[model samples]
Target: MKINKILNNNAVVVKEDDQEKIVMGAGIAFQKSKNDVISQSKIEKIFVMSEGNKKFQELLKTLPEDVIELAEEIISYAEGFLKVPLSNHIHISLTDHISFAIERLKQGFRIQNKLITEIKTLYAQEFSIGLWAIDLIEKRTGVAIPEDEAAHIALHIHTAKLGASTMENTMKHTTMINEMIGVLEEESGSTVDPEGISHQRMVTHLHFALNRIETGEPFHDMDPDMLELIQTKYEGAFVLSQKMAQFIKDEYEVSFPASEVGYIALHIQRVLERT
Candidate 1:
């Protein structure tokens, strides 16, 4: 493959089959120039990014080479352990996140992962890989990263594995869920205990509900009559659930099915009782 552009001493952009690809290896592009042919054995990794995903181009230009290599190491380990090829977007996404995180830590700005517990419970495999990455980072840089970073990294891995953009949506959904819980608390005259099992279950339920909404898979087994009975008996929870649904509609421009609303009400009622 002929080098089209040089990313760094260790990496270069090359053309293969008339498509642009960035290839990386130790000193692969050293003493190389455009139109130079790269040795096949010197290429350690090739980044075949989607045409729409051009962020990596800028990301590769600014990020430290070692930080990018660290992300590649972690991605390789994750693919081997999970037995799946992740999206090419992760190459830039994860590298950008890690580099920024390392810089933030150096500047004494520690960002906490608010969804650590939920992340661990919901995405165990991804979270495990994140932990390994954290350890690897510390070993290489001698910088201590908070365990919460594991959860943050896990979101990137999970989104790559799913071949979707749910990582950003997950943060947005969690924020919405927290606001919804605040609405529930205001209506029920109770504060949510974040450490309680009920809170965990409710968060899990809402997470799954959002996932279902994305997949267009609303609950199908709830009885219509039972929903009516609960709406009448649990007036506060039902009203709160409707308000939450309206919030969802306003934010998402989509409405949940009746069963989904009913399930939300049931979860709201349980949270009210526990709190």
Candidate 2:
């Protein structure tokens, strides 16, 4: 197997029978190491490393910025799909994961589950992958995503293969709900004492957000005009929530873990922020 391209110090691209493949992170070959046979056991995953420099062995140490970026992209996708850290083997890196996830998303969306039960059963894995993808995106991107937004991604991943038209209202309300939670405070008496009403409202907004995201026309097409509408609704929700968060903060002045604040922030962002 002749060295075609070097991906990184521990990875390279090689050819078998003139076929191009991406070989992920792997062993390095130093200068004057040409024609040295790579161990069959050493070859890990395949990559389309078209841009590797000549003297691939010596070039192995320094990876091009784009290649590194590509590797990271693939790893994220793979981690999301496999729900685990990928093996060091280049063969199992993120590129393969991204390919697999996109394929699944395209296939799963084909069959629409208009009925709730069918959705729960037939599309469960797709939904799970969607959830996985969202969580990965959130943790990686540091963008607080609400449960509803997370659910939207899950549902879309479940139904992305389908040809059904997405609804616009979903994005609008989801944004609104997030905005609603973002500004919640312990003061100004915006929060309901019972807690039930607030919870119910939050849930309701979440549902709307999910529905819109899954089927919304505006968001699906990336309409710029919708930004203002989304922002306006989000502000309304934010005002309501700001007061509520303050209320809770004051009422529970006892130190609460930052996780609680994060959770609430995520909920709000989910409702208010667009992926």
Candidate 3:
């Protein structure tokens, strides 16, 4: 194999026997350049992305090299820790997720994952891998990832552990989240700045709320006094939550807990304030 392009010190684009491949290993591309002969023993992994998976190719091009390296390392840990081979789709999905997450953090944005407890309870091994991922990321990037983000990573690992059925459900949940966000925007009489942290927080809230409801996990009880305060003070936000709750019942045929509804109102109030 010969290096066609260096993605980073640990990664390279190469060609072997007329096939283009992404090869990675520690320091494999160190001081190396295009057309350099690659030592076969140094190649740890070869990503032979199918031509049909154009998104994977695009991710390869668009992802920052460190994020690529970090995601691969995390994936490797997840597989080993879980003792299972994951869907190749994770190579694209998780890498893209990490890239965005890192950029979001750099921009001083934090997305809270309300699903953390359920995730820890249900997917312990994957959660462990998520913890490991955050530690490694902090060491490399000097950014401390919140525990909630670890749970988020665990969900990604768990999803990638299965087949199309699980992926389909995940996609369905994502679509529903987008619709719920649209409803909130309409109710608040404001368009969410898609790139803003407030938007991320709202989306995260809705996404986890859906997961929490469907999984039958217990939601935290909102304080009665504080809840009444918000209901009275942020009346519009409370209305927004009520409309969203009704939408959930009408569309998904499920009802969010009253506590969850209160949290939704708080999230709505925050977004409205930021907007």
Q: Which candidate's TM-score is highest?
A: 1
Where is the poorest 10-residue window by lDDT in model 2? Answer: 110-119
* lDDT (tens digit, per residue) of candidate 2 on 159-213: 2233422324333333343443333422222443213443444455444434443
Worst 10 contiguous positions by lDDT, candidate 1: 48-57
lDDT of 1 by residue, 1-275 (tens): 89999988788888778788878888898899999999989988877746634578677787888898799899999999899989887887899899999999999997798777667766779889999999999999988989999989998998898555567786777667767777677766788887777777878888788778778774666788998988899888888889888887897776778777888888888877887
Task: For candidate 1, list the clashing residue pairs, or say none.
Answer: none
Model 2 stretches with alpha carbons more than 4 Å out: 28-34, 49-177, 183-208, 211-275
lDDT (Cα, 0-100) at 104 in candidate 1: 96
TM-score of 1: 0.76
User: TM-score, each model?
Assistant: 0.76, 0.33, 0.59
Candidate 3 vs. true structure, TM-score? 0.59
CA lDDT of each candidate? 0.82, 0.42, 0.79
Pitting candidate 1 against candidate 2, the one with the higher TM-score is: 1
Off by over 4 Å in 3: 52-62, 171-250, 253-275
Predictions: Cα RMSD each = 3.7, 16.5, 10.4
Error of 2 at 231 (Å): 25
